[model samples]
Target: RYWPRFPRPKTVLTVKEVPTVDAAFVLQSVAGLAAKAALRGGNRDMVWYPIGHPAYLRWHEEMLRQTRANEQVLPDVWAVVEHFRRAGIVKGYVLFRKDAGDRRLHQRGAYDPSANVATVLAARLGAVMVSEDIEHEARARGLQRLADARGLTEEQCYEHWAAQCSDSVLALVDPRVPHCRAEAIALDAFVLATHGPLLERALARIRPDSPILGWGAGDEFQLTEPVSRWALWQSATNWCLNLPVLSTEQVGSTFPASSIRARQRSLWDLTWEDGVHYTSFLMTDGDNVQWLMGDFQFGAQRSWWNSPVRGKFPMGWGACLADLAQLCPYALRNLIRTASPRDDRVLMGGGYYYPDLFGKSRNSLEPLRLHARRIRGYLRLTGTSLLHMNAAKWDSPEAIRAYTVFAEEIPELQAILMVQYAPYTAGKGRVLWVRRRDGTELPVISARFAIWAHSPFPDDGPPAEIAAKLNAEPRLAEPATSDAENRSQPAEVPGFSWVTVHCWSWFKNAPDDAAAGAEETDQATAAASGAKRGLEPVAWCVRRLDPHVRVVTPTELALLMNLRLRPEQTLRRAVAELHLRLRTAQPARRSAARGFLDKAREALVKRNYRQAFLAGKNAARVLGVMP
Candidate 1:
């Protein structure tokens, strides 16, 4: 009935259709969409959602009341009713006796159990009763199951027990023809499912054994294996091998280990030789790339041999392509190139009702709009830079994955994700690679590696620590005879205070500042006409955070360039690079003062109205010309 105007909206985009029966739910659904869209700046120019807000609830309720009574309802009223049914606004449903001749519906004047007057005239009223037909459908299917399970007893069983309790159970019969699982679950109505995906999700929410009456899987499924558990990698995959087709065990690659190992070792040699050169060589490995490309698009997996005539796994198909793209590199694009619809696999096998997780296709490789969180155990680990290998075979893809899982699955290294990836091979089968993927590089795996250290403000001289008087343990409450909580001392170390350092807090080099100062100097030179103001911009060092800003104090500026931890600036990891850079250059202040004074001296000597301007700035100080 409505739409969100957004994303430049070159073409109208839609989220299928809204549940039309439940009007209450429609509001929540719309609000939910708006809340998420509000977080991003992308749709600012477009309308987020529609009009007709729920703030005016009374008008809607009256409209619903008028709709039930009216023989001919307006489209707006009908639409609202349908939205309510879909969104699940009705709190209760028809729960009538099933013994009646017709169970399809209640009489038009059926008693409203909810009315204050129903019980008041209970004995006097002879109103008809009706129930939503969800359980009734289940009884029909359950009879079918009983027939298959016991044989020769299906019809008789229904004839005896089902009829004897037909009124008791028929009222609970399955499938409300007017509505379905969406309405049932949304309304939290207890109803039976006939072996479907809705049943899976519903059973997951309301405990699987919550007296959930459903037709047993008579024809839908059967398995010889009873229970499953992972023998390795997972405790369940081992038993899952009992699946009709392939399982994780069957999902592994058959690429020869020796060949893969040789390729990896060759890459390792390249890293040892020259990183840039190796990169250049791999880019030209046309033969190796072409072989991988053909295999990528043409494998036994492409044919229906090992492949499924019908497939499953919501993330598997896209995962396969993403994996191939990563493992074989550019071959993914080539694999798609020279490929046809006939080359793809057909998808099938249950979970079709799960429109979101499985999408609306049996065998579609639609782009998955998914956000997969790679907890360290799950990420592909590559020792890119500063990565120290711990007794594991370096550059072995399998070994890296194993170690990453071990680090994450094991107790001690929990919450940590170790990544491994196939490194780029370069220059005649050699590898030049970063030792370990640094924190900056960790983003490739969509992760952040935060390190913790125990230090007592080495640069701050412990003055700040004494002033705060904090400790790891929370402060103890003073005794009744002692001071009150107000005067109680805080812990010696406060809670875990995490400080992130980006780089070395060094001043910008004088040359860089001079380059920046070029324009201003040009302007000043222009103002001076043709005279040599000798106003050359001096070189000075500054840290990234406004590093070129003038520094007035020696002590404040000294700690910045020493590579030593600065009192205020947070920079530790890159201190090594910063130290090398700063130790090689003069102090920023010294160079700055010299340049300013030199220009002033030249101006004053030339009588360029600068003798007064030379008040305190000395050119000697700037140029390092003492005395």
Candidate 2:
């Protein structure tokens, strides 16, 4: 059963401008309007005319013309009608027109299932359908003959009849009418069914060039999948791209999938939502945890490591540390070293785009100050007091500037230390410098034993091959030059004949644990040969290569570079620092701390740099600072 009730506006307000209609906005407006309308008249009836109806086409054209003429009328009239229908305030009916050509066309429905579902929901909410009267249709035909006599074609005459019929019925609608709860539910259903395609279309149209403009995405122009035929057209002419932005034409491949990066992205979102309370956990692939300690991943890792934590004991605050196999002692040391700052705050991990540091001009110092404040906030939340600022990517000038700013802004903060990307490659574990915008320069000292994060020794050939490679390269010696010359001139990284034997991370067809163990054995053998020839190890091997091979913590290495100390002197200095920290320590721990310091001094006297470093490192751990 169907009924109709029309409430004509007392005065029709003319629309001055016509803007492009957005379905999402229309849905929201309908929600707001329905709530109001339902409150105004509890049992009021309204009519919902489908946008696909021939009546709507006429109204659309007229609306456009009127808007251009500056004559006011209801804009998005179809949206208003649909909302009223779904709101259960309207009677749903097809108005009859005598001259309307091909009556079957009017009965044809919307192609989208979601659109059909919407109508069903509206009908259930108290809408009724009705057809036109036959007697009234006969009178309409008499007027159609006049339209035909006025030089109108058959189709034009029929359209005019249909348009007039729709106008007579719809003109009764008040633009401000709203709906009820039933209508709101119907809109939600429609949105759920249609959101997928809408979101994808929105993502596709986004301009990848500028991130600022990307924030304002989600334009309403739309088309869906399962097309009978498709083509890209310009002015009714088809065109094809010789080169596509993506190599694959598959749409599925273009959309991002779940991965480590996706996890990191979600964590970032969580951080923004409630950074104070949320603790994020990241499970990443690749065994390059050592590389993670390097400069490459610093910016990304900062968001996690520096995120604010909550609770009285720092239990619920900050992120958790995890890895595939058991984490290495050196890796843990590095993690602690990287996380530590003077007041025990979080690290900024440098700015968003660190490489552009030198090129971009900063008018104010607020950005740097903000990052520093974030660091301080993290420290305060975590209940910790100090973080060791070691393991840095010293290559970027901007990163150096950020570090310099941190030192300047924070009162209790000490100067930031930096390490080389790969010490074995070039720059010879020397101290580097960066020039600030004000022409002031800052020192960035390198860590000793520029240990290979991944295996540096090659396995393709014999163990002697490692020595042959290092022997071919220039020796690792400090450059005897002025600070100005060092800053102005770029040093070329000496070429080594050795091959990159072990890639730390996993691959699709990577070897299993057993095979990996054997590979490590071969790499260690090669490393030992290189050590015999004065080639230093950047990182620790799974097994010790030689008793005399020196190993030092990143901080100790940096200290050595700054002081220009030889291996024995560096070891002795580390031993002295440990003793100094334990001088005023409690009696309970004094004995244990003093024992390690004494052992370190004895090893230094024995001229065994490797043993001395280990003893010194242990003493530093006992005293609670690696410096």
- For all candidates in order, the CA lDDT equals 0.20, 0.28
The estimated TM-scores of all candidates read 0.17, 0.27
Candidate closest to the true structure, highest TM-score: 2
lDDT of 2 at 179: 17
Q: Which stretches of candidate 1 lie over 4 Å from their true place?
A: 1-404, 408-470, 473-627
Root-mean-square deviation (CA) per prediction? 28.2, 23.4
lDDT of 1 by residue, 553-584 (tens): 11111112111111111122222222333334
Model 2, residue 438: C-alpha shift (Å) = 18
Per-residue error at 289 for model 2, in Å? Answer: 12
lDDT per residue (tens digit) for residues 1-627 in model 2? 000111212222222222322222222233323332432444232222223323233333432332232222445434344546554554332221222233222122222222222222332333211112222432332211111112222223223332222111000001111112122222221111112333332223222110100001111112111000011100100010000000111111211211111101000011011101111011111122323322112332222232222111111111111220111112222344344221122221221112113222333345445545544443333222222222224445555565566545443321233332233223332444444334333344332222222345232222232222222333224232333321222223221111221222211211222333232233345433322111111111212223222222222222333223245543554466567777788886678888877887787778766566666666666665633
Model 2: CA > 4 A from native: 1-352, 355-362, 376-400, 410-429, 433-443, 446-548, 562-627
